[model samples]
Target chain A: MQIDWFTFGAQIVNFLILIGLLKRFLYGPILDAMDRRQASIRDRIAEAESKQEEAEQEAEKYRSLQSAFEAHRAERMQAVEEDAEARRHELLARAREDVEYLEAQWREAIERDRADFLHTVSERAVTETIQLTRRVLDDLADVDLEDQLVTVFLGHLQNPEDALAKKLIDAFEDADAEVTIRSAYELSDDQRERLLEVLEKRAGHSLTLSTVTDRELGLGVEVQVANRTVGWTIDQYIEQLLDEMLRQLEADLDQRLTADVSATGSMASVRHR
Target chain B: MEISPDQIVYWEWRFVTVNATLVYSWVVIVLLGAGAWFITRNLTVGPDISRWQNGLEVLVGQILTQIETTGLRHPKRYLPFIGTLFIFIVTCNILAVVPGYVAPTASVTTPIALAMCVFVAVPVYGIMNRGLKAYFKRYIRPTPLMLPFTIIGEISRTVALGIRLFGNMMSGNLIVAILLSLAPLLFPVAMQAFGLLIGVIQAYVFAVLALVYIASGARAHQNNGEPAPGDAEPSSAV
Candidate 1:
């Protein structure tokens, strides 16, 4: 068959157009869809990885907080136990000091009572003996018997203050004080009567003067009241010394306790973080 | 054996009459023209069409599908040339059987003209796609020294296309003609069957080569990342 050039060329053009149309409409969409789907899958995979990282960080944070809480609880428990031990020690020391004080006071009281009973017995015996002797030998017993009996009763009344003076002297043997009489020679009648009355009252018995002398004021009428002396003499110096020592010790203890409390508070704050 | 009183002058290059071949080529032109009109005016993506147009579509669609599979990076660009070549060659080939008709491809002029058109069109398409410098740079691979040989080789091969088709068809025609003239009826049928088979194969070979040539030419200029000839490695598209 013969093919004219014009007709052949035209046919060729038509076929070309058909092929181009099919490609543009159908094949192009398929390729574009395929590329888009690939990119989307990649994006999804990346997103999942990022989310997984965030989850892991959250889990780590939870674990860290739990461990920190446990450590803080352990620290607080230790502090509580230490505080309980210190309190126990403080109570034990206080109990021991109180028992020692009470024992000392009871011993001092028993000694004082024994001395008083002895002095009272001696006075009664001396008085009774003098009366018996006077009845037996009536002519020689008048003024001499009265003077001797007065001496004996006054000596008995003075014994308790003397014992108190000795106790004060022993206690102050290592301390600084001067023993002396504030007033000795010039006693008014009321002062003498009041002195006798107060001495008798403090000693727990009635007293008589051995002599009308003033030299015994060196002891300053030392007498016991409620396991303590109440006169202005050398014994008061020991009381002042003891009170100062106790006050200084208590102030030191207060400072230490304050420091401990402050330290514990700051430590607790550190543990909180 | 008888000499008639008046007769048309016969120009035979060996066994083919030049005038007869010319007349047959004209007839092919006319037939293709009518087919083109029937196709162009009524083109549709829908299913309804005359059997002729439908048949043409099926043929064109099948060839387009194959060309697309070459994974031609720019199948669209080369589609017109290759598609037209396919359709024209197929029509001319089948027309050889149209009683009292001869295939234009069975003549030298037609196949030569077709091969020349491809030879010219391919380079032109190549140059257009990639400017002149880049198009010429394609021949140097698998190395530069082979360029002279390759250029000559390409030209000869395209020329050989014309010679090959002309020789084969003319030989087949002559042999069948001699047989029919001798036997008057009996042996011509067998020879004609052989002619049809040869015609169809040559047509197919011509079309396929045209496709591959267009594919190669367009493909070379395609810096679009298609696998080179020996590198026809398949890959997932997406």
Candidate 2:
């Protein structure tokens, strides 16, 4: 081997220039592409994570809305039940008031009916008494015979408990003559003693006694003296009978009236438009 | 006594001496030593001075400027190796004109020594920058099938570097010496001038080739692969 400086120098310059060209053209493209790929992958991963978070937020919002809806529904149902319960209580209270009003009206009607019945019975009794007195006056119109009869009637009327005694007592009072009284029916021992005591005080035996069981007057004794007589019986009085019948009728009518009113009111309310 | 150009002078131990060539090699040594000293002394960053600094600045500036133009990060990394090559070669080529001075670079041994140093340095730097495994693997890269051929080519290139330098320098020295002895006056001057021109050309060529070798080795390790098909070219001259 021999040294060749000329050739070596020329070769070195040529190789240097060759290397400069190769570095510029080659390697640059490959490295640039690799760096770009790395950056894009990092960005893609970040985007994916953010999207996942957004999805989760949407799911949470939907869940919250569902829960709120359920709670609201439950609250509405509770309010409806409470309203129904209050209405039921109000209806029951109205029914109880209606019943009480009917009972009170029934009692008032019974009192009114009793008062009417009593008044009618008392008027009938007064009319019958006046008619009997008129007939006695007509029969006494003949003079001597009438006087004798009147004396007898007057004697009878002196003891007013008997019908005959009450007529004799009326005749004697009309003629202004004294009268003797007698009883057809036998008197009890206590009754005889009461009659004698009365006659002795009056200076005459002038009492008439009778047992009368009339349609109007039931059982017991009657006494007559002059134009006065005493009448007593065990039967119910007209006023008392009237009062009992009126009470029963009034109760029935009042009950019916009250029931009708209540029924009509209930039907009208149900039929309202 | 008659002597022929093909004759050899021998000593003990197989040492052969070429008398004129030995003197030329000495001339090469002195010129290199002096140039190195002159360039090193009074080195300054400032401008506006003697032609020596300006001349050096041009040469160094050209090398570094080319390195900058290549767009390498550290041009100074190759400065010592490349700069030494340029200076040593320029000194070796110009030393032929000095009386009783020999150009050592004209011998096979001197140029072989320089070439071997370059071969070792390329691999060492490759391994230092990369590693032994990486530097060695550069030969087999791109395709493993081409490993044997690439290895043979690299070895041949290194051997040729030594042979080429030795042959050119020796031939030129011989021709100049022969011409000066036969026609010592104006004819010799023409031949010497021819020698000087060729000498400068050889030095530039050697230094540029050195840069190529260094760039290839360093770049191979940097690439971690063989040169691509488009990047491949014939190795430079010896």
Candidate 3:
């Protein structure tokens, strides 16, 4: 069990030298390679993080822009709707005005046609009433009717009012003024002389008188003293009755036209609404 | 087979004895150095690599992982010392299968030399990691009463590391020699194969103990930042 210090010393030196050689070649290269790999992996992770952040920012920006565009489109659509409504109102108002004008013209033409028809009817009615009266009078007349009318006229002149006497006296004062008498039938010479005396006595002046037959002065007589004349006849009585009837017919036509025009106007107003 | 390679002295020059231990240790060193040079000489920094290069890298990686897992924070600083001890011992034991070759680990001289390196390396790593004053101050920790026990524990463990490896490797050779004398045939061959297994086990045991001793000293003066060895690494990976 002897120990040799010399051999032990040499082995220690050999182990130390082997450590140095292995360290230089083997451990150094492997460790360096592992460290480089770790560094490259860290760089890649950092780049990926940066790219993710950028993509998020871009997405946010695009979302905001899209919402803004939608809002703008909605606003434009509302404006267009408002414009269309306004135009519709304006055109409708114009159409209503045209309708009102056409309604007024139609009423005017109706009124004119009604007036023309009324005029023609009134003229025919007046002529027919006058002819009917004339026929009735002709059927009922006697031989004394003419003389009776002349006598009544003479009686009026003999007992005239004061104003009538004054008018007769003024007419008699003219040197060219002559009293001319007309009758629907002929009278005798004596009757004429009698009528002249009566007139001179009633007027309180000397008067010249003339007599003639005028069938158009029907069933009556007319006298002319200078520019003044007085007479009575059946034709005048028939004409007065016809004028009253024509006036009533005109009033009735005016009422009917007024009702028709007002009713038409109400219908036109409803249409406009 | 010689039980202790030290008894076989190949040369004697003055008082410096060049025994079978020194000669065989040199042979194992040359083989290891040459093999290391050959594998590392054409290493690629890129992805494509030779199969031999891959095998060497796997071996180197495993050694570094063991040192780091034992609570040594800086594995590269300890790699030169720890990796060499493992490779040298394993190469010596594995080559013992050769017919006339003596394993250096079968001699007490070589294992003593390797254990002495671990003992000297402890203080060197502790002082370098923490300062001189802080490293020496750890000897008196718990109380000054622990100083002698701490010193004796350090020396006893170093001696145990060397003696344990020498005993295991030398006993394998002794068993094989005894079996060769009895049968000199099939039994000797089987014992020699069994000796190979014992040699690999002893090499692994020697390298792990050295790593633990070195890491314990290296981390002694450091702050309580060192994780537990199991928490730091998966033991099944290596």
**Best candidate (score: TM-score):** 3
Error of 1 at B86 (Å): 2.9
Tens-digit per-residue lDDT, B1-238, candidate 2:
1121112222223333444333344344444445545554544433234576556556665766655543345666665566656556667677678764456567565566667767777787667667788778888777788789887877777777766776777787788778878888899788778878877777766666666666677667555575632123335333
Chain B of candidate 1 versus the native chain B: what TM-score?
Answer: 0.76
Error of 2 at A152 (Å): 99
Model 1 lDDT, residue A134, Cα: 40
TM-score of each: 0.40, 0.40, 0.53
Q: Which ten contiguous residues of candidate 3 chain B have the minimum total lDDT?
A: B229-238
What does the lDDT come to for candidate 3?
0.77
Off by over 4 Å in 1: A1-273, B1-18, B43-49, B141-143, B221-227, B230-238
Using Cα atoms, each model's DockQ against the true complex is 0.05, 0.04, 0.44
CAPRI quality level assigned to candidate 3 from its DockQ score: acceptable
Off by over 4 Å in 2: A1-273, B1-31, B44-47, B66-72, B180-185, B221-224, B228-238
User: Which candidate achieves the best lDDT against the true structure?
Assistant: 3
lDDT (Cα, tens digit) per residue for candidate 3, span B1-238: 4568898887787987888788888887777777777777776755576887778778878887888778777887888887888888888998889988889888888898899998998888878988788777778875778789788988898888898888888888888888778898799888888888878777887788777766666676564423224322124211
lDDT of 2 by residue, A88-173 (tens): 98887777666655654564466446545654565455445444443443343333442344334334435648665444334445
- For model 3 chain A, where is the 10-residue window of minimal lDDT? A162-171
Sorted by DockQ (best first), the order is 3, 1, 2
Ranking by lDDT: 3, 1, 2
